[model samples]
Target: MVSTGITPSGIFHIGHIREILTGDMLTRAALDAGMEVEMIFIIDTADPLRKVYDFLAPEFENYIGHPIGAIPAPDGAGKPSEGGNYGEHFLSPFVEA
Candidate 1:
């Protein structure tokens, strides 16, 4: 089994691509070599928010040290939105892509 993990503290970025793709490539290579491989992607939603980023609202100060998956996602104005939690909000697009 091949495992890849990412902390969902902020938005997905290019750096994340490298790690996830590396795991995927390894899995593909092993499969091509006649090995049975299972790839698992782990999202560290239980990780705490370290700070309020420039892209996040000042209101997020209330969430510091709290688990990201338990807090609300930021809206366009950087305020908390009703859509979903921070982890899912940032991860959805990357996973969909």
Candidate 2:
């Protein structure tokens, strides 16, 4: 098994992609080498909202240390998601990618 983890605390940067891609490439290479491989990805939706992001309103400061999945979306993307959680909001795009 090949495992990679991401904590959606802020922007989805190139470093995040690099880790995922590395794991994926390793998994694929193992498969090609006649080995069975399972790709595992860990999304840390429960990570805390540590600080108020530049894009977020100052009110978000009140949510510091709260689980990201329990907080509202900073951008008010929509219902459920708007109030869904921080990590998942950012995580969706990474999953699609």
Top lDDT: which candidate number? 1
Displacement of residue 53 (Cα, Å) in model 1 is 1.0
lDDT of 2 by residue, 1-97 (tens): 9989888977799989888899999999999999999999888778788877777777787888998878877665322334556777788787787
Residue 1 deviation, candidate 2, in Å?
A: 1.2
Question: Clash number for every model?
Answer: 0, 0
**Candidate 2 colliding pairs:** none
CA lDDT scores, all candidates in order: 0.91, 0.80
The 10-residue segment of model 1 with minimum total lDDT is 8-17
